[model samples]
Target: MSIEQRDQLVYVDNGAGDEPLSTREMNPLFSSVLEARLARRQVLKGSAGAAALGFFGLGLAGCNSDSDNDDAGDAPAADLLGFSAVAVSTADEIVVPEGYSYQVIIPWGTPILGSFPSFSVNNTGNDQAEQVGSHHDGMHFYPINDSSEDGLLVLNHEYVEPRLMHASAQGVSLSSGATPPLVGGLRPADEVRKEMNAHGVSVVRIVKGANNQWSVQPDSMNRRITALTPMEIHGPVRGSDFVKTLYSPNGTMTRGTLNNCGNGYTPWGTYMAAEENWAGYFTNKGDNPREHSRYGVPSGTGRWAWELADNGADEYIRFDASIKAADATGDYRNEPVCFGWMVEIDPFDPSSNPKKRTSMGRFGHEGVVFAPAEEGKPVVCYSGDDSRFEYIYKFVTAANYNAATANGSMLDEGILYVAKFNDDGTGEWMPLVYGENGLIEANGFTSQADVLVNTRLAADFMGATPMDRPEWGAVDPANGDVYFTLTNNTRRNDSNLNEANPRAANNHGHIIRWKEDGEQAATTFTWDIFLFAGDAGESGVENNKGSDPNGNDLTAENILSSPDGLWIDPDSRVWIQMDSGWDDPFGNCAMLVADPTTGDLKRFLVGPIDQEITGITMTPDQKTLFINVQHPGEGTSGDQFAGGSYSSTWPDNTPSTRPPRSATVVVWKNDGGVVGS
Candidate 1:
């Protein structure tokens, strides 16, 4: 597939439509660093070769060291990753190592609750509320009583493609991500409702049978949290005027969580869903507030035009945040403010209402990753704003973490900090407080709530570093080193290139890792590049990329791009998943494993055509691994859709006419040994 074809696939799943380039007027810190690197390259050009320059350390050494604490879990045996690398593939199927096998489970529209309705293209809106959602992204597997055989699998549904969801769009010549043609300038109410129902999270109980295959089971814990579910508001922004609306006059509650992309699990066992690209779900035509404008809320209509539902119900109409009433409380003008938050849910408690944590500093959240919890220590976590030239944020709770009583309330009161990476390999965490760092009433920040509601604007005022589309974040449990994936930033040019983000027009992204000076709550840290993702043959500082420990170009066994979903296993093996649109040298989205200590990377699995490989998790014993395949066949064009065909029919190879369905695949070694062994 070509890059254009891959762009179409991305459009179908990306909630934010064609994200605008960052127009913030912050200083470019990387230009000097880039110049220094170039000068050093000239000095050592002949003697050491380019490879030596590629692997030279900036200021830090021993990028990955074995931890003495072993806080994550028991460290795996030596030679942690021993599996043979797989080759790049474009076949419409899951490809794993020779000894590994996989089984597909809980596909989109799979009935898990209510009357157990079977999946059908014509399923009612109500039926969709009870079924598994589409476009699975970030996920977690919570073991019941620490048993790897049975557990609750929780995952996020990032967005939905209408052409694949409704039978009414069968013969429609709609482009990818485009909604079906409107009937008399209004969409059918039920179709709109079903689309909303498919954008959220799913909590289902799955168990391993005698055959070693995981299957969904009938349990009270099984539930679906969609875009219409009632939820509570918590944290600094809660009960503030910024979030007050007709539906939530008290500002203590809101309805639904949308565009849930990356996710996290609290030390207390609660699940945190990051709301990404949620701004596109609402539109403000009258006058735009800074909150809406900074977050990229459209002025015309929502991405799906939910506000134009023919039924004209209040819930459906709230998508349009126009000034219909005089005050914010009397209209949905504040409805857009109620979103763009990290929603916390208690997966084990079916009756509990999910809470939108306002203290996390609302933006386009890719995901949240918590440091290893230490008793009596302040709880700390990090999140990245998944947008071009956005800043990364960290939150430290005012209260100490106690495993026995730690809950979502700990997130209610905290200090939100934006990162500022300096040119000298050191970085500081700038607090986004109301009265500090020029964030006072004179600067339009009246209170803490006001500062948080306009997090991006405040970060801009505080001079936070503009990153290259920061995506999923992961913390190494053994050493507390933080890692973040700066997926491709095509907008980056020579004028803004820095040592941290070295590439100009970075087509293939890189991974950045940092270690706090002393404690997890430290204000400063030393950082370095973990690896640069690119094609196997490309080799140069400007266009090609290199790996860490040994600066060498990627090999056929390990080439990847758009590193989105990331995870560090208990043994410190770095698992990276791709969400790439560049499929020329790299065939399809794949999952690769890297030995953090040696920086030895290898491809573990490759996914089907036109799909993003994301949302990975494994059982406690490392025997059962689960990964999501999102929007398989997403590259299908208007002609293919009109002809009743698709680019892929994964997980359901039978019935060639069946549309592709996003799903979770369970993988394990046939010999029942540890995965990736």
Candidate 2:
């Protein structure tokens, strides 16, 4: 497709644009299992149904409790969601519960490092490298000496919108997420650099002061790891021949991280940034290998056309992986293989190089959630591939986690497994090892490095159950139950329906929770549907899907769709954030709180027009909460943008002048109580 034609497809109803769908034809579908389970549910509705529900741990009351705790005869904890739920809104500002207030901090282009250059559309690429990046997604707050009032705030910058970011595109009539007109068939080098600088992670020191206000505090630890930052490659795929490129001939290093969507922190006090939707950053017109083809690398041009920079520098030209020589080392054919892995960064150590842990496997990694570490057990974590019909994954370290010596190296040697959900409310984790389960040399997987490089193909071959777009994952600290958000999937039809994913043409998504049979590293588990997202007006088996195991449905107090960002607090309250298109009965994307024990849910906060509510974290005391507002004026048309009109101008609220910016919002209660309460 021509560059102009591609630009026209950039802005969709959904802000981020749809992820490339999985094209594996032979993978097993979870729909049949779901159909069988639903049939069984219809036939057995009395005590037999109750017994079946208990077998799957589907009892709504106290289902998240441990088996030992259930037998202890302990009383249930008091309700934690005490605040009145907010109403749905389309206002160009934040709306929270009645007892709470919020402050906007560390917006895009806000300087947090050297020279402290102020924010401006005309800021140079160098200035962008020193300032906060754009479109904040997943985040984590690291406490300083375990203090609730002081800490390091680290977040991911998913991607950039050129029309809103560059001053040169002010009157160029560009839609949201569309690039400006090409200059002499090439993009301006500085514009490309600035966009690249805006697509990574940021670490800033924030302090809570009097009046419960939060502000950025410049410290030595404050840093910006952008697309131009240098990083190291570790694990089995480090020095493989598939990753040898002109930039890193030794295949042990790569430059920059892209499309950092979801994030996680390790037990050893380091941050991990997930590389999601990164395949579109490169164009591979020649020699399309399975690694690039399975990930949907464009054959014509990249999403942003960084490879067509006017200066034709090595860094920019390398984005076009058209083979230029006989071997991979002499060209950039292997450049696209370097991305799509979780990058580990130490927020406290400013000079440390971020390491990409290859043992975790590579795909459209929405995020990684690590289970609480045990003394003499392996460190276990779960991740979901955020693509239609993709599979969820788990990684168990080969070495047991030792608090005294735990570090990123533990991620270097691990077993990566894919999930398979069955019709009997049970699931298993199948190993994606190179030589196991038909992943041998005859089947095209030559080594462990090859399996890691083509993780999606390996998972498909293992007969893993395909799911809707799985986004964020959360683990309940009190009961060790794992929850995953299956964001909306409009492509699902009757042919692909399953027990876990029962809805066809699922516009609004659902959340699924599972409990491991024994430990976090165990392969077998029991699964159940926690909640289904929808509007109050929609009902029946196909539209909104049925309610949870407990009869919960759409109410004024609880309506949501596309559950993307998720977290479980110490009090066992499930926090859900939405990222969906504009729709009725649900005015805009929002955040909600749910009591898993009782299946009671309520809306907590609603965001501005055309914005996504994502990336949540909190202080050590749980009295303060932090969430992100991304792409506030996302769906504005080209004419609207050129006429100095936008859908939203949030955090600034100026009169049709300042473009809306993605920013972090800090929320606290008026009575100094817990945030949700």
Candidate 3:
């Protein structure tokens, strides 16, 4: 595509122009960053003679800690960055340092397009194609250059869990207040359509105010890409016969992306969204030998038997694979081949058709982490397979890095490899290339298309090392070492443990790191377990590293469980997030800040009751922290939802009081001072 054409696709300038959706607006931090940058550029443009003077850069800003004004004795101040911790136990309040405060910028479903009316409780509408998706998940705030007054916030809506998202609240029979069984694995047709429309991502513009806050840009630059959105296929696998279905004959197009989890923004500035847990959305006959053998759908294991639903909508009925059609080439029994890959989105332009770059090698992609792209060097990425006993993967693009092409187009060509951890604390990057690694030569494999279609089998054939439920991964900008969270695996134990995964029944979970050999993407790397989290006292001295001097072991002070969200700040400070397992003794989920080099980890903030600390992002200044509180009180049902019966009364405890909604909160220190100092 030409640069102008690409720019139009990424910049999103037409359609509704600009207008704020709500009469009442709150200043958001996200928009402030953009405004500040814009003002700086405006000054330079308006006064070139004065602005052409020598540049004077500012020194490092630090997070300051609050100290008491005592004449006696006080502790020394720590040298943290421009960040502080503030506790927000409720939604109606934005608690921060004495000077800093936050406001609700975007909640669920405020109309993005003109067709959909404002969202209402239990309101059913067919204008889903033009609506903001339900349930916001992972997101990023991109300041358009360092000058534009506005920027885009690319957000992912992971999935729409029925009861919490739909009109009928998961199809419960109101008379008896009973939920129908989630059996035969079939969902109602309308429910399926709603879900399909709500599964993808949204790119909306945001602006800032002089007071340093952000707000959403109403109708301008607002676009929603749903499961029904027409998308193109790119890479070697595009146009392959395996992905063909009744919907797309050439296999060059597909509908909506599902289960988009954590994401990565290219150095060139576009968004890379990974599709996860999408396989279970399709249906196939449990008895068809040819179908079962071809895709390995495990007989009777189809989760969404949509073909059998009572609804006559073809979109809802497509998931079924049980019926035998005279022409195998025309029906959707083979639809499973189309999903589970990384989809790229350009936030600047809303009209661009998102592309699922197939050469990245599809699997249960939790997230894709890119190494800083360098000229003439391989563009590398690290990804995890989010299943128990699954493997970790890496992809090195074939193209040389060109700073000009950083605009999210570099992902088109790549050599995908799977990891194999050895018993000697070392690992190898086994190539899963079409004709190499015995993948094509192995049993039950026919062509390169087959290998990509069933990537798990290809990895298994290459002897890829199995890992404990690997979730999200982060590449250390300072050291190029990759860190991934192995959430927990009940089936693993001492006897079944191996070099890469050493623990069994790993309840508390651990973070694993590996360095590519000589910092080369194609070579193998050294590996080790960074830390083991568990109930400090019960976990034993061996896992704890050293005794706490007091001799007492199992203490809450030393305990942490199921480490989930993880981020490495610019300065290399590691922030760890924990998701309290269902059986966790910890009362709430929390985010911990730690110095891995020194093994000095401290609890920073805890989440509300019954929620997981998932999405976490910080500003370039590191002055504020934006965190997501997902699925609070998930166990409660609509029929039993009420004031006291509800699991959590977060953000809001009044109004209908049906249930708690997942929300994102910004926390910072008061006094306009740096936090953690």
For residue 397, model 2's alpha carbon misses the true position, in angstroms, by 0.3
lDDT per residue (tens digit) for residues 1-677 in model 1? 22333222122322324342233456545544455666645654321112222334433443555546458576654786889999999889999999989999999999999899888889889999999998998999999999999999999999988988788888887766888888999999999999989989999999999878888999899999999999999988888999899998999989999989999999999999999878777878989878787787778768888999999998899999999998988989999899989999999999999999999988989999999999999999999998778889999999999988888899999899999877667889999998898999888899999999999999988888989889999998778989899887776787887667777777778888888888899899878777778876555444655453345557888888888899998878889999886667788899999887766889999999888999989999999999999988878888988987777878787534457999999999999998986
Residue pairs clashing in model 1 are 30-498
- The superposed Cα distance between candidate 3 and the true structure at residue 647, in angstroms, equals 0.6
| TM per candidate | 0.94, 0.94, 0.79
Question: Distance from true position, residue 172, model 2, in Å?
Answer: 2.1
Superposing every Cα of model 2 onto the true structure, what RMSD results?
3.4
Residue runs of model 1 more than 4 Å from their true location after superposition: 1-32, 39-62, 67-77, 538-542, 655-657
Question: Which residues of candidate 3, in runs, are more than 4 Å off?
Answer: 1-104, 125-131, 147-150, 170-188, 210-213, 286-311, 407-409, 538-558, 582-584, 637-639, 642-645, 655-658, 671-677
Model 2 agreement with the true structure over 1-677: per-residue lDDT tens digits: 11122222232321235364244574646434454655545643411112234445444223644565656577775777899999998788899999899999999999999999998888988999999999999999999999999999999999988888788888777866578888898999999999999989999999999898888998999999998899999999999998899988999989999999889999999999999988888888987888888987778768788999999998999999999998988889998899999999999999999999999998999999999999989999999998878889999999998999999999999899999987667899999998888999999999999999999999988889889888999999887889999987777777787777767778778888888888899998878777778776554434653343344446777878778999999888899998877457688889999887666788999999888999999998999999999888877778988888887878788735568999999999999899886
Name every residue pair that clashes in candidate 2. Answer: 30-498, 31-497, 31-498, 34-498, 34-499
Predicted structure 3, TM vs. truth: 0.79
Sorted on lDDT, best first, the list reads 2, 1, 3
In Å, residue 248's CA in model 1 sits off its true spot by: 1.1
Model 3 Cα lDDT, one tens digit per residue, 1-677 = 11112112111211110110111111111112223323432543421111111111110011111222355366543343233443323222333333455544455555566565665555443555456565555667676665333567677777654455455543352211122244454456665566567668877776656555666667556888887778888876787767676778778887778778777777777788878766555555544433234323334433333344555566655565554565435776556667778888887778799998887777777778888777878789888877667778888877778887655456767677888876545679987777775766547667666666667777877777778768778876766767788776655655556645555466556777666777558568767555566654433434322111111222454345667777777756677777653334454677766554434455566666556677666655555566666656544544554223555655566426344556666655455443333
